[model samples]
Target: MKRFAFALWLSAISLNAYADSANCHQKANTPESIAATMDQALQLKQQLNSQPDPVVILVRQGQDMSSRHLTWSHAGYAMRQPNGDWRVYHNLNTCGTAESALYIQGLYEFLADDLVNQSIAVLRPRSDIATALQTLLHSAIKLNLFHSPRYNLIAWPFSGPYQNSNGWLLEVFARANDAQVWSRNDARRWLQLQGYQPSIVSAGTFERLGAKLFTPNVFTDDQPTELLRKGNVGLNSGDSVIRFIAHYSRAIPGCEHQNLGESVCVYLSPGAKRREKIKNRPSRREKIKNRPFYANRAACKSAYLRRQVVPCGPSSRIIPISVRRSRAASAAAQSFALRASRRC
Candidate 1:
């Protein structure tokens, strides 16, 4: 009996060790990777500090979906606080699980998440739109109105039962653009009226079936049956959302492209800037094609979680996405924790 008890203890320890190794959230934080992430974050901070608007839509390359022809994998709202600090508000899926929650994280925390590349994009809405978004970000009630705990990596842009991260951001943007957008349905309707087009992602039956069976975070039920039959899924993506915003607002001419009221810039790394650098600054469309996404934000006035002050310096190089209609592509792409603890 004693021998059997000792054996059971040993098995439990082995199981615990295996579980730690199997943690899906594990990241390879090499020194080079950590430095690159900090470089991106510091540059973003500078850009945000110079922004006149209180709120901007920030997109990042959280995962490498190049195989799927997608550049960005996540989008969030970065709002400047009264203290002059910037915080990112977005819904995040918990460790690739189907359940999700909203998170109000520091700029560093947002960028530090396991990233595919150090690319990010900034979409500065028109003055009025920015004002509306700023209010919405502060109001927990308004943000939660369209939020659903049920999450799917490929949630259909116009359906329910599941809402992907980008889908939530799109709906919230619609609400800010049009006051009549009170519910998720109303937001989708408003988006359609504004000519917002979701990118169609193509996946074969085997691929889709495999994802559904093994990955709890992916589902095709929210996708239209017609699309499913053709093996094409229409979903919200960073590129699609950016294009629609630029087109709907009317794209401006240069790097600092302006929609009817908003300003959009895609930040490129120094290395990329040299490789794809044009003789002269090109039109927004040309810049979009030539450069990657992302522009840095304001300085970090205070620190949260860990670390003292984040070193902020000059802004990173930025380019813009074109407003023209392009072939549809898809990329796979958080919530507030403070409020939940009180509830618990």
Candidate 2:
């Protein structure tokens, strides 16, 4: 009984943390909140002053509360300014639309999430890579071209169809490491070759269908083909980005495991080692192309239509087999819907 109670308590704490972290994007506009946020940013900036490198990757928890496994959700590049202050450059969906814009804001504004806990992770890259990233960020044309207007919540790191906040950072990181890379697809391929695995967000078939039909910002076209085949999507989270950096780059001293206010700081060494080539694998579509009813758009639509039914009324006489099945399916769907809402 004691163990069960302890487990229940742990679950409650986890839920609270997830809920708080997930709503970090709702900005607090009060003067007191703004002042406190600025003070926290100033403290963080001061901590970065001792680092030798001029550029670092800044990570923060996300505004998505539904994900239990995700601790960090957003990331951006921080570069030292002429006056020795660090400014963050990243894409943000500020207008609550499917559109996002690239902005270079001060550390406070960058960390202005209403639910932002006192925690930030900083990963510093090698001098050469930092120079490359700085150069790319300084170019107005490059920023404009790379800035995606549509924001896809589950935007695949490799696809060009749409992008989320983290997708933009992933592309910029890829381009910084390789000058020859010209497109988002190329960048994603490069990261794949480097063995970067994005975090997976799973949903039931009904949940996915509902999201597709209703959620404008949740799209599947930009998802990797393999994930789409499995009825899942890849999300580029800040934790995943940090993992990629740690895998490829050395961690610098003094930047690892230091406490800054309520936040812990980690610093990575500057340069990334070259990754060996991964063996070629068949694309998701290619592997599933011959399968019967492999979720082609028309087939999916037909299946959905076949399962949709209205209630039998006094004016109605006979209920078709399809309608009967659909009614039964509707009952099952209600149960699943309850579960899906709880998960979200």
Candidate 3:
């Protein structure tokens, strides 16, 4: 009985050792901090609304990775639902453990993470690719095929027991781009074929030792020994994922809004510039189609109060009584609200 009890205690200790708290120091919830988070969410919503595509890769500056010269620390799929509401699908570590779970959250919730700044980067994939990704994201089993609960902050791209959030996203993207990529290995192969490169982060000996000893979700064993010895580690990161998408589909830079209220958008391809020059002004027909159809202000207020605020026009201006066009929502939209209730 004593031996059995000792074994149980040992097991408990092992579990606790591995389950190191993963929470990092977060910014205090001061008024400025709260405002910054709200501002970022608002700006992101406005920008996403301007895009024609329903899905785009949203990168966040959640952590101060400036020491590694990395700008964006996380990436997630921002998808617009049929009801015109936006949602972010991403993997989040579970309760400060090495385990993680997928989270489907709103723009406000996504930006509320302890962000280092209010800046964000958006990568708009090609129309076909975006459509393919949207379909995959809607799939039940397919979405989890590349997801591993064992979290690693700097997981190796090709193969590893653990996976990072960005790494999971890259695998899913590979599967979407190539139908043959049904497995993680196949996804990695496709990524290699497409010349997808992982971002290199420099970690010296002391830093490596410190991270290995203290951090729960950081691991270096998956990296090559030679590279580790040289203090260079290659891992999947937001920047690397964006670079791959840019090359694979020739996605133009959408927007990089910094914390200082400055917005910079650079279109690499000439076609993107021409398209940008052509303002997306709503046509007279579209304006008429989008005009509200409510009979009076009372009916419009009732519909709005019933959470029916959708299909608002590009102008999205507040006018008397006319509610947004009340079109029959598609099957996808009908099912979207149901999916929102499911555990991610």
Collision count for each candidate, in order:
23, 9, 1
Best by lDDT: 3
The deviation in Å at residue 224 for candidate 2 is: 4.4
TM agreement with the true structure for every prediction: 0.68, 0.64, 0.65
Write the candidate numbers in order of decreasing lDDT: 3, 1, 2
- Summarize candidate 2's per-residue lDDT along 1-344 as a digit string, tens digits: 43243233223322222222223234448997777777778877877787766787888753433433666767888889989888888887633345667878888766665532446677777778888888988887876666677776667776667787777888888888888888777787888888898887665455556665544456666665776678566777766777777544445554445333212354222110111112245567665443233123333333334643333233222111232346667776545434432322
Q: 1-344 in candidate 1: lDDT tens per residue?
A: 43243233223211221111123655668998778767767778887786576988777765545555766667888998888888998877765367777878888777776554555677777778888899899899999997888877778887668887777888899999888889999988888877888878676676676666556667788888888899777777777867766543323335543232244676655544564556355887875454432223211211111212333333322222222222332111001122221222
Query: Which pairs of residues collide in model 3?
Result: 292-323
Give candidate 1's whole-model lDDT. 0.64
Q: Which stretches of model 2 miss by more than 4 angstroms? A: 1-28, 64-67, 224-226, 255-344
| Candidate 1: 10-residue stretch with minimal lDDT | 329-338
Candidate 3 Cα deviation (angstroms), residue 343: 74
RMSD of each: 23.5, 22.9, 21.7
lDDT string for model 3 (228-272, tens) is: 889778887776876676654433343433321122232212332
